[model samples]
Target: MRSIGLILLLCTSLDSYKILIYNSKYGHSHSNFLGSIADALVDAGHDVTSLIPVMNPKLKDGTENSKIIRIEPDQQVLDSYAKEKENYNYFELNSFNPLIAIFMGPKFPKKFEYVCRKVLDEPGLIDRLKAEHFDVYISENFDVCGTALAHAIAPKTMIGSYSSALTGQHFSEFGVPEAISYRPAAYMTSLDVHSMVDRAWNFYASLHHKYCFWFLRLSINRLMKERFGEEYPSVAEQSANVAYVLTNSEPLIEFAAPTMARVINVPGIGAKTPKPLDEYWSEVMTRRDQTILLSFGSVVKSIQLHPAVKAAIVKTISRFPSITFIWKYEEPDDEFAKEAAAKLPNLVLTKWMPQLDILAHPRLYVFITHGGMGSTQETALRGVPGIFVPIFGDQMKNAGMMEYNGFGKVFDKNNLGDADKLTATIKEVLENKKYRENAQRISKMLAKKPFSSKEQLVKYVEFAAEFGASAALRPQSVDMSFVTYHNLDVILASAACIFIFVYLICKMCSRTAVKLVALISGKTKNE
Candidate 1:
């Protein structure tokens, strides 16, 4: 493990550019990703400054190859996160159900503005960012205004990082059409969990996301143009033109679309390393026994599980006493705790386990995940088959892709059955050699490349800084007619149809009048 870390450290020496990585939000997963990339860059011998907001942060120069800029998260702003207080409640089936997940698309602009204003006002944060002339700005695509803010301050380029499915919704904002059916890699092909009806709904939901992202981009660009001068390019143009985007996912976990060679595959960047306290490893693999890790992911906590669903899982897994169940319960409770004891002797309940650590454990055999990108990568890297319970967003797409690749199964919350099915699925993954074989094959492919995806991304950042945005990417369709740009083709086609119909009607009317006159004159002459 130390040697692997050393190798990673040595790889960092390959980079020579100064890069500023920004992830001001509080989520551990998001921050961990930023920290990973920054560490890699600094290890490579580049001047790297990281902007982070933690309650109490530790900033030690690990390799003496980079610097850390620590800013206290604005308590005032942190206090205003009233939305964070709301957790998923499975009892309120309305809240935890898949239907509600579709409705909870990307946040609106007002919400984004609220977050942006707080970030800007975080006492000297903006000043600190502007002071450091960054060559490239890297951030999660979901964080609304920070990237735009970075773009405004210096002649820097923006690189987008996201954990899961890079849906049509995201690319469409940059004028790329939604090709929902086009899964770019073998992993995305496995994620076909939707029924015919679910597929249609997923398509519409993805299309809806495109509009949501477009609206947000439009609003951000408009505000930025007034404040910074030039209208910003679309996210797609920005993505395509940027030096590189390092998706924290593998081609084996989700499908990425093939675009102009800028999007790079850098899997496992967000993977969690194994932790020591995972009791399931202790319980199931005491002497090399096989184990299965069950977790719903960070956003969808297991404690939020519907009581019925919990009961079903307990009843089913109770039969498979040989396998270990590491349920990621965010909080502890008497009922859930006792239920674990009653279910199976091999069941080891955990409030939290180092997910990546648990997956990487040698005895681990299967994973039941919410199909998060981070978890997806960990599962792929660990070479484990999965039972996917897709709750929302790209999770649905990811679950579908994994199933498509013969590595997993999708059990929708609405139709998830009894313990027999659950036990059967686990047995199938454990007994069937194909699952392990496929997972290992994909993991090998993910690791075959010489440079980690982040290193390649750093190269792109330097490329963008050296060359202007124009050099990195050209504007696609700049003729900005509001009506024409949106769908003038439809309007033009409609206008042509109207003209033809009018001419045909006029010609028929003239012929009818001539016939009527001729008939009247002939009758009068005969009389």
Candidate 2:
């Protein structure tokens, strides 16, 4: 009776916090990542509120479970955003240019600064947030507005959430450790950090990424100061003060680097468990002996694919008459896509797809993907081999991992027009039994981890709420200057000491030799 009573008391005494998760409802991956965290917290019995801004109209729901408050940017911002997006082709070669990043990267966020301005100016919203007295505040670091919103709320503990793998910003601004010697950069094609050439390229790419990211962050910071008074802290300053990050990076699969204790890894935090396929999709998967699903993710549309590339893909899939190919072609009116779809009886064209449901299908043999982290992480545990076609940014790095892990191969984007190459690569993955075996092995390993991603997330949140900004976990190197951090100052000092020591010894030796010569000459004269 006493033991049972003690157990009940312990359970009752455990804390349930009021958590405010700010979802920047624009990018599918970013919003989905934050939304999942909100739902997870709510499921864990915390009070979770989702503060969302309508960055993209398509992604309307910030979170499925949390209490919602939507921020609508003025029509000017919306009009400008919609205008820019209408013409933007994210898959273009120069979309990731550093000069463009430095110059025009902030232009979009600068416009969206109105979202934060509106939030702060609203008396009712401010009063309601203050009333909540949130124990923990979490927001995506892609935009500084979300982080700035944390300042207004003044939550007990503030945290930065990364939807994808942490980049150079996490190392330079926050306390996550990154090394040029061994860690791969997200922007480059090379994944193997051990090779000298790869390391050198990584050094160059890492510097480029850091430089570009600096300007991006700088632009956002200046915009914050311009909109809100100078009293607001810089985004980097706010991130550092948090002393913790919840990232959607899987340690088991990601390129190994030094990571702080506070930077928690929860890979599947945003992933939904695969639900049973509906009748239409279930019937389609079983229609063929094997199925191949081709998708370029939400941001990178299939319609933007070069006509030659589309022709090559259509030709390659046509070679396999037994395989049922499901292609997520975003546009219904593409004349070539429509013509090819009609001729190829096995090919199915979709403007939208239940990608998760399709990937989980038993008959699904392979996936041709854009290597976006959201899809990559979700697909990795499904035991399906893929041909990764990376478009840009971290996607290239994500594609390289497919080959690194031996479950799949990285297809060169430049060779997409070559039907022969495309067909050969697809055939290789299809014929090679080892690819399937390796994928299954990795899936089982990921599934049998010590704890689930949700448990890791919940425990870390609880710990952060109780004890904010852990100095012990934060690397002192985060604040150190380049010279200091690299030990170059200490190296120069040691070099100077060594030079002086050698000079003194040489001088003594020369003096001794002169004295010896004089003594020898005198003795010879006396004799």
Candidate 3:
């Protein structure tokens, strides 16, 4: 048909620009996410270069049609900041992945400083990146240095973070709903319960980020001024204000904030291409059996699970014969996990399992997760209910949001006891139709977008590269005073201050009146 020919002609005329992605010094998931974006861009005829921390073997083997640049930060500098002992938070130094602590939120600031130092000291790293002459730079928001690198270069920057705008990255300033803000622990969101908490978290995080921007600007200006004769003009303003944020999420899974206009929800970045069910998993999905996929994600293996928590899961799942539990663990030789696997006929434990592949299976009835954003997005994508046991960082917030949407349940990892309670919750998710219906409804909404979410990411990056700046959805001109945003508290404080001032003035005047009366009475006594 003429229409088909014209479509082909239009596609042929569209040119792909050179794109550079930077994701260094983070978990494997972030690297994989960047790689997926790069792969997508390359497939779309774009010249793509990926900059990642030199860790996994897969990263070393550069993919065809793409140039992969590895940055091995100076080991000496890394060693200086990194704990000599194997601190779980700095686990990336040990092997292909980093060991995230049970409490990852409090430790992030130190990690940020350590990463920043590495970016500055690495010889030839910045120069090599500059040499690429990239038109656009794509990176995760947590990689502050990556954003800085993109700013240092003339290219446009698009941020892709696991935390989304919840961490006060983009949407917080733009009046996005606060219920999605970052939290220290994991919990489920109940529509009637946690919306207020979410809003409070967003308010704090927004202010925190505003402070960060000011601090970075001041530091950069001071550093540049000291080194060069002139004040740093680049530090004077945000570089291009970010064309838009490329979120690795679907809006249907969660209520997207004011950022809906700027967000490009490119879900399933790390997932395998959707294909025909291979029969093995499909067969498993059949029957009246309810199923659950349990994993902490690629970075944190199930083997690292605290023994008490592992025992709780084992004991809980043992009681349910009709429900099947699949735990993606990493101990091929560990006898403990194997023994548990042997003891529980209803549970399937494996050294490695394809998570996305499993979640997509029709039999997947529920997800027991650590509340990682990527995993939550996948859970939402499959229209599967979940039980959230957040370990640390923003996992709590993710879990809380899911609970709020009525798609999941959340519990604390620190006090994760009572196998009976967990088992009961699992049974509820399986038996109740509400969870399934809500999840399906969200899935439908996520699928309504016109194009692949990554395409939006690509378009924004191209626009930024072509146009020097993007109109910031969250403008920097707005007043950040605490009094202005949350006015009731300020009004109360002002009222109290005025009352005290007036009372003091009146007391002083009354004392003066008493003194004058006393003086007049003394004159009468003298006469």
Candidate 4:
């Protein structure tokens, strides 16, 4: 219930630091994440500026707050993006190819590289940013260019942020813990590790990430050397200075894993408290005892969903006549959507819906989602059970996380069109009391957690400002050789010591027996 406005009033005694948040225009969730940080810092009476490098020519910041600097993508960047977009339909597949998630579609990294080059080459961009004299710099660690830019500015305190759970990806560069024994890798298909085989796969997945991140540093260091003098620091060296990482993952929902004080788990950081509903949705909620909202989010178009899947969803909705369904279909005007809406009065198709408010509705029963981190966190915080059909990225693992947390079920994307199974899954989540109970319990825990996410952000930024990327917070484990970090050297040394001790003992015993046998033989001869 605490408003940012109220927080602003109480900020009179606080010292305001000039902070810059580097944002990418390519991703909706990523932009929304950076926007939330900017707004939060501004609310805390800090001087915050969002420096957005627009990668997608078509995409722009829909909502505006003051102090935003946007560099539009140039023609070359636009052309590259269009070429990349051709292969970007990776998400529109029936079944998720888990292997591709591990490598990450090559096009994105290429496109990001091109975009970063253009942004860096922008006239006066670096000088303009440096002129701000920012004390703090915050950026998502996914793009090393952002970190490189932060290094050029050389803020007193730098912070890295993640929009999704820390998937043990790039933890090496970020200096966060990535022990794979219990932790799930970013691209791992599931959060639940039951067997040694599962643990082994998680370890390999985590290692793959670490290797890729290491290579990325090499790649970016070359770029840094070219841009600045060859004396410029490597990506790893620059990131080593980051004070802390504000992660979006809620710790309570996660399985047991090693974490560092440097990694701040700010659950529901960007999630907004639900606003009051208007007359239409207000009336609609009252019409049914149970209501469900189905959305695949902005990036994944529901219209593009397979015909069979849509049919299965429509069939599932028909069976639940008593439970009203709200579908956020992009093309509500599509013939299939129109026909379905006409046939089923309980099923409503809308191009846009007040998603947060709908989830907060009193009669809200369940949510059907793509398991995007934003949706996953929002649904969890609102105490809504869900059926997740993850198509790509960490979504598959995110779906597993939700199910593991006990508030949801992961419906395989390939089987989404199966009416019997789809209906059964929905009915199970809807009718089962356990799912709702778990959701409510977790939601209450998040709401009443020791620190408000807003407070964590404000307090941490101030802490960093005071101490300036305190190395005391970092573990000595960072930058250790692979053998040393795993203590394999120690293990090998101990094994060798045991072998030598055993060998010496056997040798002494053998010599003693030989001397005794010789003495016995001589005594027998004399007799």
TM-score, per-candidate, Cα-based? 0.76, 0.91, 0.73, 0.90
lDDT of 2 by residue, 1-527 (tens): 99999987677546678898888776788888888899998988888899887767777564799998888766766787687668877666653466765676546455556666666666678668867888899987777777766766788889888888888777766767687677778876564645777777777778776665665567667766776689878887778778478898887667777877788888878777899998999988988999999988877778877788888888988899999999998876579877998889899998988888788888999999989888888778898998998987788888877677877889877788899999999999999998889888888999999999899898889888888777787677767888998899999999999999999999999999999999999999999
lDDT (Cα) of model 4: 0.79
In candidate 1, residue 346 scores what lDDT? 69
Question: Cα miss at 279, model 3 (Å)?
Answer: 6.8
Q: Per-residue lDDT tens digits of candidate 4, residues 1-527?
A: 47877776667536788888888787777777777878888888888888887887566552256388787776777887676555555445523244544565433366567667777888988888888778889888777778877768878889988887775444666666676777777656574457888888777666655555554555666777898988898766676678998888887777667777888876666777799999999988888899999988877777777787788889888998999999999888889988998999999899999999999987999999988889999988899999998876667768878898898798887777789998999989988999999999999988888788889998998888777888788766667777997899999999999999999999999999999999999999999
The model with the greatest lDDT is 2
Candidate 1 vs candidate 4: the lDDT winner is 4
In the range 1-527, model 1's lDDT, one tens digit per residue, is: 99999988777654456577766544545666667777777655667777654432333322233465555544544444444446445323432234443454434454455555555556776666777777777766665465566555453666666644455444533333345554432122232435565455555555555555565666666666665577655443344444455566566555545553455556666454566645745555564377777887655667666677778888877777666666767665667767676756767777776667667777888888877666677777777788887765566656776776667677665644466677777778778888788888877777676777667755666666566455434325333344665688888899999999999999999999999999999999999
Model 2 whole-model lDDT (C-alpha atoms) = 0.81
Compute the lDDT of residue 190 as modeled in candidate 4: 74
lDDT tens digits, residue span 239-356, model 3 = 2355555666555555544444555566666556545556665655563367788877655556655677778878888888777777877774588877887787777777666677
Q: Highest TM-score: which candidate?
A: 2
lDDT of each: 0.61, 0.81, 0.61, 0.79
Model 2 is weakest, by summed lDDT over 10 consecutive residues, at 105-114
What TM-score does model 2 achieve against the real structure?
Answer: 0.91
